[model samples]
Target: MKAIKSFSIGLIFFVVSSCGSLNPINPLSLLMGNSWALSSLMGKSLDLSQFADGVPSLNFLEGGKLAGFTGCNNLSGSFALEGSSIRLDPGAVTRKACPGTGEQDFLGALSKVGNLKIGKDKLTFLNGEEELMSFIPKED
Candidate 1:
């Protein structure tokens, strides 16, 4: 009878410990397969009407690929993430005669991104602790 009780306790403990081993949601899962639109840059809110090609946006793709628009030009790049650290490399940008300086500003900010913050509804790029750009979920 004592052996039966000990065996039962061991089985219960094993099941409880196994439940804790289940992985929690990964933060990277939040970024992948999501489209984010630029809402602010350098502490200033953007006026989407001012962009020639609508608001700038980013689509994080699988396998470390990135695709986006720079308000006037289409942007393609690669990104590497290690924990919260991020490196954004702007690869090719379509050369179109853009009116305002929004595209330039966007690219410049992208180059400066050294870290990232993912909030409940926002993605913010930062150079160290200073925010360089902020994005929101792109409307479907």
Candidate 2:
């Protein structure tokens, strides 16, 4: 009985120690601040700056709110974060037609995003397991 108790205690300690914690930045923190455009692609890298209308912009607010000019129309949407997964609620945009390959690409990429991964300097929007777009921080 004594040996069995010792083994159980050891096993418990090992199990507890082996488990890791999720230290992902609080989703609220991500939402409360601004995120800039780094790179974007649904299938290929598109010029992110062009979409900003010379604004160098990419920003997201709390509660999944997002906005930026894709060198065309302004885009915005509601987003949700669950653990490591993200869901972009159907986004809306201005109806004015944007002229340029960059605009078309930006529109395509935004429509496909289904998840998001935030890094210290980058936020990667993903569709399933593949990256759809990436955002970097701009100096204020």
**Please, what are the lDDT tens digits per residue for candidate 2 over residues 100-125?**
56766666666777777776677788
What local distance difference test score does each model get? 0.88, 0.67
Which pairs clash inside model 2? Answer: 51-70, 51-71, 64-79
For 45-106, candidate 1 gives per-residue lDDT tens digits of 99665578889999888888989999998989899988889998879889998888888888
lDDT of 2 at 48: 46
Number of backbone collisions per candidate, in order?
0, 3
Model 1: residues with Cα > 4 Å off, grouped in runs: 1-25
Q: What is the lDDT of residue 25 in candidate 1?
A: 53
List ranges where model 2 is wrong by over 4 Å. Answer: 1-24, 48-52, 55-57
TM-score of predicted model 2?
A: 0.66
Query: CA shift at 17, candidate 1, in angstroms?
Result: 6.6
